[model samples]
Target chain A: MKLEKIRPSEITPEHVYLSRRRVLRIGALALGTAALSACGLPSPSPEPTQTNPRVPKDLPTDKRDEFGDPANRWEEITNYNNFYEFTMDKQEVARLAQNFKTSPWTVTVGGLVNRPRTYDLDDLRKFGEEERIYRLRCVEGWSMVIPWLGFPLHKLLREVEPLSKARYVRFESLFDPDQMPGQRLSFYPWPYAEGLRLDEAMHDLTLLVTGLYGHPLPPQNGAPVRLAVPWKYGFKSIKSIVRIDLVEEQPATLWNTVAPHEYGFYSNVNPNKPHPRWSQATERRIGEPGRRRTLMFNGYERQVAALYAGMDLMKNY
Target chain B: MRVWLRAHGLQALVHIGALIPLGVMIADYAQDRLTVNPIQELTLRTGKVALVLLVLSLACTPLNTLFGFRGALRVRRALGLYGFLYVVLHLLVFTVLDYVGDLALIVQTVLEKYYIVAGLAAFVLLVPLAVTSTRGWQRRLGQRWRALHRLVYLAVPLAVLHFALLVKSLVGRPEPLLWGALVLGLLALRIPAVRRAVARWRDRVRHTTSEWRVANRKWRMANSK
Candidate 1:
């Protein structure tokens, strides 16, 4: 029944039809693969962001280094690392912290405060912004010229009535393992907390920063909320905070508790005393201007110097 | 002595491979491209490659037994040599780059980091195995050679640990777990019972693939014709 109308030529044509179909199928597949360059395809893309910040010479400048080298875009932006709450590894802190939704974030202020309160991000913003140029020294012996945009910590403290018994302010990072994977490993004592002496907590130089490099803090750089203690090593600048417990005793710090010799509570950038391994006198600038000499109290001696007066910094360190 | 030179030559080539990265790293440092912690990255990369090569190198022994790839015997030496070569490179990068060859820093790292201790122990174990891989050393050691080589099994897990600590956060990417699985799978397959079981499975998979290929070929030819 199938061959009723087919001639000998037509029979060969049907056979040829199958062969042509096969050829067409192969040709289509080849073309499809060529179009896709195979599913496991290769092509051009931006080189992995060796993302050093680059600022034009014309960009308005405020902060400069010890050498009086003007801070460029990278120094201001790229160098202000957020390896605090999550991982100390800069790249991993950036990568692993993508899921941290800064919305609904509220800094729960408790402890010595006479009026305990939870200030959501929006309410905190009403406090306004001030751009303070300061040097940020890292525990790993790197530094950056950061013109931080945030209100003074003194202003934030004024909001809540203090408990007279409270002598130190302890800050805690958001502790969800789902969001902060660095907590999974003992990278830094999980939940990444820090505290300040009462006088130090009320210092004018201390900052509750929400932005840096003139923009809202990128999620990796601790968006919405973080502490910015310019005089101390970068670790003191806790990121993605959730709690602030004012205490009578010096609350345990992650580094000082873990390795006391290397990380002292008085982690003021002292050029005189070296870290357990490396010299503290210098730090890599982490931008176009390259490395520069570190300064005493990260060059904030004029504003924060009175706080550390007469104490043996090396002994405290 | 020529055999000695040949063995050393193989290691030298690997050393050169290891050093090329070092040269690039130094160039990066000079050019202001290297990160603040260049040593950490280099050590992690070297350790990673060492472990992968260790698995790939160990794979040769199993494959030789399974498919009867007799030529793999000569190649196995090179593969094992490459593993040892990479491990030594990993160690060197840690010592020179991380600690700047500081004895004090080395002791601090060993005490502070269990992972570093694991890596140090692994490297220490691999030293004798690498030296004894040579025919002269093997003949010299005799029965002791077999005992020494068995240490490779323990070294693999210690090496795995060396890889794990570098994982700052395993939130989204579970590549570390997969790596752990592969290492564990390979080690488990060495058990006599597991070996017999895997042999049967391998034969089945081999038979299935061959038949599938035949079916595919026939269909293609018929359509073409």
Candidate 2:
């Protein structure tokens, strides 16, 4: 209750003595460093850049590396989400997902696959650690550069190869109203689902991301499983996946079902094709000062451009 | 005011629990768990709770009449104060922190948006009621007290209409419309003409539903025996 009652007179002489001692200690450290330099021991080097400059995702320079490299503060993860069933309130999912059942997660691989197998999260993790740095573009026109640690969908697909008939891979999230309260909201069609072209699914860049920034994904950030398509808008990367089905026909996505004009099945993050309501080219980097411009195919044109070679992105979007 | 304080001392403590959501929400914003403008979420959330308490306050009287519970009005005074407190906070937050002295935008909201206008109207109506709620004022005003308090009937529906119009066009939204319809239905039940019509309709329904009750009673007696 007395929060604003700070009195300068309360500071004793001993406190001033301690403050002086700290400055003296810092001065001694400076002298010691200079002396060490004179003795031929190397001076400490400045911190290296946070991101791996070689990686394509690191090309964007106007960003704040508040999380440091490979260990992002969990803030960005909780805030940036597309759990549409949770009333389109991005933070609501993360706040509301504490009650979600992440354990006992088993991905059922079925449909046109030769071997339809149910793999627990442990089974998937057994394949081991592989980190891929990627840029995630939200359909709402924001972006983040994240280093996601996970295995490729192709790696999993090879274990249970899709038949020649397979043209698309459909992923479904878990659906238990008791566990996921978003299901209670009558607005969203729960058991959120997303689809990917077989070619896109097979692409080296496409991943079934289990971790971000070298840490296991938090429950809110889609614990057991989530899709990570580096080239597409983040909405296409559905979270809390339970089933993956390979189909002959191109599959529909939840957003396209709700608003065909607003969201497209091929919601690839092409900066040139603006979303109807907002500009897609310019994006607010999550932890940065300036709004950085987005890139074509989220700056992965070389890797993913060929997949949509002849198609007009604007029309498709 | 003194009577209210004495009567609601315990109730005040219980209703203060409503402030927890605001604190938790602000904490989330500070923690960056929510990307929304913090002030915006807080304002909307407080306003929403205020509207809920207001609606719930009104529902008590009618609900008592329908359910034969006479003591329900005991809670209305405290609940009404909670609504008044939250509404004041909601309005203050909007005019002060949210606008940050942008007089033009504030004026624009007061003028352009019918919902904000209605909300402002409701708050303006509540001020005199809240001030005159004291026993002293009641005694002073005498017969005029009833006239002053009757404004609540108008304020409640206007507030709901504000919410309904405010939320109508939001993407994938229907909650406000449902609540609006519910308030409209409740208000309709209070009008003498509409009340009589509904009584006829409801009496028929009670008769129909009561038939199942007699059958269930007989089934229960047979099963027990």
Candidate 3:
């Protein structure tokens, strides 16, 4: 019973055999992961191009005011959006809103306004662009510093010339369900409405944003035109405006209409007044590792506090 | 190989399936695929997996009662512990990552948020069950172990409620409700009357099949002779 001597070539090297096993394990795991991920987990979206081709390489920026926080990366700001018009999933919004039509867009400014004019995207842009870096704090306890490009809403409001009867300014988003799938959901009072007091709407800090990071606003970030009320929660800054109505009474906003108790009409970024579901004391700044203390009026108290001077924010909230 | 698979396959499947999500999560983290808000992503993923495993664990008895799938019983403990593991991970992500180990914030959240309270309750309830899952404790505890494990009935619903209440919009989000429905159905199946009815139906089907098999065998034997 003589055992046959094995050739060097016949036997697999220890490292080779081990590596083969490792590869097999990895392959199996990867296959399983892919299958499971396909079940629901969001896949990374494709790299996006500059949303608007006509946007300039350089724009006149406001260099005076300093918040000291770095603006979130373009990808972070664009990819993570709460454009429920497209989808509830923040990451999916960018992908879903890729083909959204913002051209030939007209925003009608009417109710209780003297001019009662419908301004096209071109007409709105004539107000001229200024790069204003502002902190956008979401009601969901997330914050982002974004360099927004557009003029103040007050400029547009002044041109429209609000009547004395006009107390609240209501903004409505584009409501085409064919394009905005989330609008199809019957629960949300659709056309995604948001409102601001006349004073708040006319404030210098209240920007009617058209672009961000030197590029025309991406659809997910509210393309063509949107509002950026830095002092209020991000939702207060309505996206993709289709209508602006100045009425005597407060307008019905989407979130407020949905859950008035949870989402107040005056959803100011107040750390003291906690949301019914989550704490407002701290917010995780997007692209940052840890949570930071949420600021009173989102760190714009000095600028906007005078407007809400006598009013009770806690009661309003 | 088939016989070996038949005896051990379901357990192997449960173990592998249970760990796959954690592996995928780790892979996602390494690859930077956890969306822009990784903490929220991690929290959601871990919470969801925990809820699913816990629900699956709760399904074991109902599965056995309805279908006589004893393999479900064998993996029940493993399913539950995996669920507990995920719950722990979920809490860790929320506290360590999201809250940055800020105990004050965690306390505030747990106190302020009803959903967080519900989730915390579910996790606290599961702790004892996971601790006494071993055969040694099971034997010592005896019938009490079964009683103790019945906390799952409460824990599962609480977990479901936690998920349901946490969602921004309940109308658009049907997952928590679907999971609730599943848990409800599983709970309903555990009713003694329902269990007896299902067991009776199963027995009747088995009895009829065996009778047919016997008759066929007899006919074949007679013809051969």
Give the TM-scores of the predictions, in the order they appear.
0.58, 0.52, 0.86
| Interface RMSD score of candidate 3 | 1.2
lDDT of 3 at B216: 99
Per-residue lDDT over B1-225 for candidate 1, one digit per residue giving the tens place of the 0 to 100 score: 798866565455545654565477568768855554455456666676677777766666677766766555556666667778878888787667545577764675476656677778888888888888999988998999877887888887778766665443344345677777887887777788988888998899999999999999999999999
Model 1: per-residue Cα lDDT over A158-239, one tens digit each = 7787778988999888877777665677545677778899888898878998765544555676666888898898888887
Give candidate 2 regions above 4 Å deviation. Answer: A1-72, A85-88, B1-171, B175-225
The alpha-carbon deviation from the true structure for residue B23 of candidate 1, after best TM-score superposition, in angstroms, is 8.6
Q: Please give the fraction of native interface contacts (Cα pairs under 8 Å between A and B) kept by each candidate.
A: 0.03, 0.06, 0.81
- How much is A196 displaced in model 1, in angstroms? 5.5
Candidate 3's C-alpha runs over 4 A off are A1-65, B201-225
Q: What's the number of clashes in each of the models?
A: 2, 0, 0
> Can you write out model 3's per-residue Cα lDDT over A1-317, one digit (the tens) per residue?
44343222333322333234344434445565443222210111232121222122223232223667777776688889999888888989987986677776899999998899999866886797787899999999999888888899999899989999999999999889999999888878788899999999989999999877655676789987899999899999999999999999999998898888878998999998977676699999988897999999999999988998899898988
Model 1, C-alpha of A119: deviation from truth (Å): 8.2
All candidates: interface RMSD? 7.9, 7.9, 1.2
In angstroms, give how far residue B93 of model 1 lies from its true place: 2.9
Clashing pairs in 1: A53-A74, A112-A163
For candidate 1, what's the TM-score of chain A, rounded to 2 decimals? 0.75
The CAPRI class of candidate 1 is incorrect
Q: lDDT for model 1, on a 0 to 1 scale?
A: 0.67
